[model samples]
Target chain A: MNTIDHHWQRFTLRQKLSRYAVYLVLVLAFFQSIQSVEVIPEFLLDAPEQMGDMFSRMWPIDFAYYPVAVHDAMIETLNIATLGTLITLIFAIPLALMNASNIVNSAWCHWISRFFLVSSRSVNSLVWALLFVSIFGPGVIAGVLAIAFRSIGFVGKLLGEAIEEVNMGSIEALKATGASWMSILLKGYWPQVLPAFFSIVLFRWDINVRESAVLGLVGAGGIGVVLDDSMNLFQWDRVAMSLLAIFIIVILAEIVVVNIRKRLI
Target chain B: MAGIKSVQNRENPFKHNWFISAIWLLVVCYVLYTFNAMDLSWGRINEGFGHASNLLGRMIPPNFSRWSLLLSGLIESLEIAVISSICGIFISLFLGLFAARNMMPSWVSTPVRALIALCRTFHPVIIAILFVKSVGFGALAGILTLIVASIGFIAKLFAEAIEEISLKQVEAIRATGAGFASIILFSVMPQVFARFIGFSTYQLDSNLRNSTMVGIVGAGGLGGTLFSAFQRFDYDFVAAILIVIIALIMFGEFLSNIVRRIFR
Candidate 1:
């Protein structure tokens, strides 16, 4: 053992050389491809001319129609996010509790909950939206359901971990006092987990707002409908305007969410 | 008297015993009501399942007649995923570092953090739509969209990882007369590098999945192919594309594991 330890203390210079060789080859390959690929066409610079022609046809961003529809569309988007987050928040609590091995008190229940959570989280929100649109005929309801389903998995998993990390000592103490299981949870677990739960809710809300925009592509309803319309019609100006609007809304919401998160976390 | 008063206040603290119970009851009732309202009937569910099964049956023999097209789309999607991740991660490294409140000034961190939050505020699909509209239908739009999405997630997480790091090592390095850059390079980065790798790999996996879907918005990828298949009701092709997507994602997961191992 002593002789092996003595030999192990030595550093090999060859190892360094081999690692550098690998690094150099990888970097070289990256630059080589960059040099070889003619990504931009000869006519690429004419892109601005095309853009200018499109812009000239629909100049000024149509501010006259902004008040007529933007507010309603914006509200609809918010409503989708709200309803989705609300549904997820409601479904997630029990699932989170059930998924937490420390809370479930049964092996089968824990495994089942784990399976459910994993499967739910495996599919992305867009995929869920696509599936729901196929089944529910594409509207706000489908969008809400999609977001809600995705949120359930995310919130449940994170909240379950939070629940598990709560002080076991507190729960043991409550149980020692002859409290019921429900009472022990309400008193011992809820308060400790509430702050994290609130943060997750706000964070998810920020995400759902962005997701709700495109839900309309499959007819789930929102600015995505407008976006699709403009694109299909090749109304680049309208598309640009809508894009600008979405950016502003997202940035504003982001500001609010960041402020809230800072205060909480 | 003061002690007694405090105890009484603590014990009697406006017991909203019924309030909490009522909230829980309301939640349960709302769920049941919504479930029924959604018309998620057993018969309908069964019918849907049957239709899905029929679709799946047709999809078994995936016809790869457009092999070249599919391969080209797949390559573009991979390019989008890789290029976006590289660019996004490079930018995020600086943004994240700047946004770390403990390391940087409040004025610097605050705005950077806000920008990250904004980037993350929207889904990548919506972002793709916006980019496609601005940049026109192409891989450029897809790359830009994924980059925005990456910045949103990676920067926020990186900032968080940095904030959570022990400043003790950083302080020790500084005390040893190392420059600010050197101290960060040696002390701060080593602590967060593994976590940064973890976040990057996770983002890459997500980006790969997203790259396929960006085509739906005309940003460029297999998603456009998938969308057309869906529209044409080509269930077999859809199945084939789905299988391919799943394989790609699984491959990405394996790659991520390798990355994590290397970083570790």
Candidate 2:
């Protein structure tokens, strides 16, 4: 009896070469990043101590301060998120209609809507808040606008994708009936996209809540204002309270969104 | 005959869902309440539009005179994003395996799931602020904050990916009498490795977007420069910074898309 040699390898020579190249690039990138990211040794060494110190100060949470400042700020934060989501729906629906390739066949429309949506998404809410704060002078209006602007991109993009994914048969049926464009949109696409639309809005609203909570840091008005104020004052206890409030609101918002989305989709 | 007539008769094909109506009513009520509670006057909105146009006009031509300063801030953000993503992906690779219900017992997975959820609950900006307080600010704080975020997101997705894998394949690997680690390496890893790559690239993209802004809280990056630009009313420079950030995020998205295709 004779046995022939057997060999197995995960990749061909070309694949191996490419994989090696990728690894080499990653290694170089990592080293370049580490060198550029100057780490102060003292600060690095004291991080644990600093954490411990902060935690110590945060202990004995200022429950009393919650009612005084955090409560109203928290409520305002909720309002901002809700109002922002509602406003987003207004702008987003039209933009989404234009963006969807299935809905608007014009190449020009797609480009214009895509540009608007991408620009909206590219700028972070904080940056938007800063811009709006300058224009609106830092208040609920700025906060609401910032949230709405940022969300238009997200809500519009997802809604557009949902619109694109609808069943063509139903749409064709509506068209065959000699329905007008508006009627077809209302009778055909609307029902199909409604579930997706609800879920996306709820999801975006959930995110907007967390986002608005921090817009106050930029003076857009929300819990972040209370948080920034307490932090600046070195009122560690009050900061702790505000943080707690923010945490609870976030969890509650998550719960509500999950419940609603489950029932919806 | 009456029963047949009544059965065929319907006002609307769609049943009126009370749940949806309630949600709509609630939304309307909330918006109305918010308007009443907040002092968002129509006059203020009109005046705001004037200031907005003025601000937009000033931002034109996007001053690149301070190109060198802009370049440095952009580089720092890139470095923060790369470092944090690398560290975060590395951590999540292990954390995800532990959190997967199919791979681990209930006791092990439950606590890890809770930890991931806790990490996910807060916004990265809030986390960045806390890290700034603790780590005394710098790129270190940003890196830490983003690492937490990346872990929270990627690990959950990874665990979910793991949970959905075919257990039949795993049982087959076991039938061959392979060791635990070998079984994972041969059977489980093959199924999930592609998805893991996808998640890592997505995390990198997210971290890049987030790293650009963490500097707003002084954790480190373009944020501080951008904030200062705003303070000095350097609208042109601010516009330039924003342009750079948008370009950076879009580039990250493109890069991730390529990476995903490669892995796929």
Candidate 3:
């Protein structure tokens, strides 16, 4: 038994050492971060009590402010999402076409479009909102533009993939018929990708609805502005109301998108 | 005759459905009305172009004068992301198992699903605010907030992945009279392990992006530095921070790609 164990240990020595080394590094990093952040065990012990107190304050939401403050903001949020999705579709369609390897034969165009998609997607919508707020000044326009810019990558990437996955048989048939490039694209590729494109756009719209709600935190303008204001003023009841509204709207958007996608597919 | 009759019965492909058209019309009207109410006029838009150009001019020559401040914040953000992702992934593994309807009873899965849904309802920024208020501001709050966000996201995906796994292997393991833990270890995990790795890497990427933003609410990270710089109208500094953030995110994207490749 001792000889067998020794042989096994010798055989797996390198693999075991490398695995342990990786885990050791991760553990060290975790502890270092905890120390740097000064996370006190005593504070963690008291966290539940503090959270309970906060929840107690938030009970019985001030629904009275709903019509006055939240209603308009909710509408603005919806508009931002809808318009943003519309704008995203407008830009994403052409960009997706360019990015689709099957459609765009030019390697440079595909790479350029892919770069745009990746860079756009890499930055969070909040950052985009911040940039737009600086330029457009705090309003729904900034919110709309932020949502649009952030969603372009998501919409474009999905649509491009869908286009790439299109049936080549139909495309070749169109080509054999000596169809014009415009006709082949419109009659061949478009039909195949339309369902997926619509579904992707609707799904993005659902996400944008949730995202646009928070863009107002950076003064991009939406329901999040109301949320930020309530929090700053320590109006827990009003904050609760806004949160409730956001939750309901997000769930509703999800349901709507799911239904639409079901129909489209 | 049947093919000809089928062709004759087909509707004109170019004609739009009435129901869809009506929906489109209503949407258009709502958009127009919303635009009017928001006062998004062309004049306002034109004014924004000038502001954009002016801001762009100041943003040139990105400032790295506060290199130490930037470096510390970036490191802290990275730490928060990695720590939260590890913790979140660990917790989510169990939560996902409990929430998998195929593996668990409805009574168990229902409550777990509801908990996950509640976790997911609010944005991370809101959760970070709540954590900051309760726990006091710092990386701790940021970490807690992101852990919640990660669980909310990946747990659901993980549950779905588990549900979609083939039960044959599980049944075979059970037929051998293996204990629950052993059966799960031998059967359940292997099938979903690859997808779990994919989800974990994706969560890590998302957490990295979010860690930067949570600092805006004073939960601790580069966002705080960036926010203060913006408030001080330090556009050059802001530009530098933005550049660093973009680079960090791209690096994360690249890392996730490599991780996925390895798993594949």
Candidate 4:
């Protein structure tokens, strides 16, 4: 009697070898990173206790402190976020059009716009705020400019994608009529991209609100100024209050974005 | 008169909705009001430009004499990214399943969703600040902050991925008399694992960028050095550090692309 042989394997030999190699490399990297980390053993040991103590102090948050310093700063943060988003559209629109291959029709123009967008995104808002604060001598304007510069990449990238995805038939129809470039853009791309453009703008505005809340930490200006002052003064209660305000505002901004996007899109 | 009005309407193909127009009007007014309130006059902006150019002149020819110091900070940021991404991805696997509406009961998923939301609500820098206050400052705080950030983001994405998977696979597995856990292992996981890898790689990239700066809050990395250089008016050194950070992020982007290709 001859017995039938059966064989089953989830992966081939070469696949298994590659996966094992990847795993080996990952393990080596993990241990290497662990060795380089400089953790204070004592601090690590008492982390839970330290966390408890900090939480205890944070309790009984000073709600009374909100109106005194946080109120005006919160308003200024909203203004910075709003103004920054509005200003971003000014620079973002042209750059987005330039970056859209179908719209710009020049590889050189597209690359220039791409470089600017990438550099803008690579630099964090806080870093931009640091640079702006030095130039503006520390104020809301620094915060606003920081937000605008950081947002240009995000808004431009999304808007460019929307432009690229527009119905080509409409554009071709406009071109066939011997329409001017400006009119073709207005008649063809504008309607197709408007909804997406508004949605992207609103989404960015929401993010800008959260970012602006912390810009003051770098002395650019916002509720973060109050947060920094409170932290410095060891006023944990006031810090707690500031955190609460930021939390509420972020949630509210999300709701606003969702509602506006619903109607616009 | 009606014929003339109809022709005018035809001339303007786009109808002007008063509701949208009203909203636009309100936005314009609000912008003008806020502009006035910020007190950003032309003179101030002009003066700022003058200062900016002067500062720009100082940052030219970035100083890299302290290459060792810069290298150490860059390495620390990398380590923090790696460690946090690993731990965060590990934890999110469980949290994500618990939070998936289709996989778990509402009672379980609801609280998990809320917890994820809380983690996501604050910026990692803010979390790093709190961690610094508790952990007494170091890479540990930065790692913890990024872990929370990772879990917040990836868990939510994981849950959404799971929800979108075909339930027919689950039913097919269950029909074999397989238990709930086995069903999840055999069916649910295979479907979402690819997307989870994508999210993990993206999170790693994000964590790397964030780790470079969490040091600003004394969490530990290049950001502390950058902040100190800025305050010290060491413009050239700051420029050098910014260059290194951009290079690091670009390298991370390259690494992630390779990883995604391998998995795909």
Question: What's each prediction's TM-score?
Answer: 0.75, 0.95, 0.92, 0.94
Instruction: Kindly report which residue pairs in candidate 3 clash with one another.
Output: none
Tell me the tens digit of each residue's lDDT in model 4 across B1-264.
555544453556555668867978998999889879988888999999999998989888899999998998888888998899999998999999999999999999999999999999998889999999888889999999999999999999999999999999999999999998899899999899879989999998889888888988999988888899999999999999999988888888898887777666
Better of 3 and 4 by DockQ: 4
Candidate 3 residue A49 Cα shift, in angstroms, is 2.8
| Pairs of residues clashing in candidate 2 | none
Top candidate, metric lDDT: 2
Candidate 1 chain A — worst ten consecutive residues by lDDT sum?
A34-43
Q: Which candidate has the top score in TM-score?
A: 2
Name the lDDT value of residue B176 in candidate 4. 96
Residue range A15-111, candidate 2, lDDT tens digits: 7676677668777888899987867878888888988999999999999997798999999999999899899999999999999998889999999
lDDT of 1 by residue, B104-154 (tens): 999999999888877876678877765554567877778889999999999
Alpha carbon lDDT of residue A142, candidate 2?
97
Between prediction 1 and prediction 2, which has the larger lDDT? 2
Q: Which ten residues in a row are the worst by lDDT in model 2 chain A?
A: A1-10
* Runs off by more than 4 Å, candidate 1: A1-59, A105-115, A174-188, A255-265, B1-14, B17-75, B95-122, B133-136, B156-184, B243-247
Per-residue C-alpha lDDT of model 4 across residues A58-111, encoded as one tens digit per residue: 899999998899999999999999999999999999999999988889999998
Give the number of the best model, judged by DockQ: 2
Stretches of candidate 2 off by over 4 Å are A1-16, B1-11, B14-22
Better of 1 and 3 by lDDT: 3
Interface root-mean-square deviation of model 2 in angstroms is 1.4
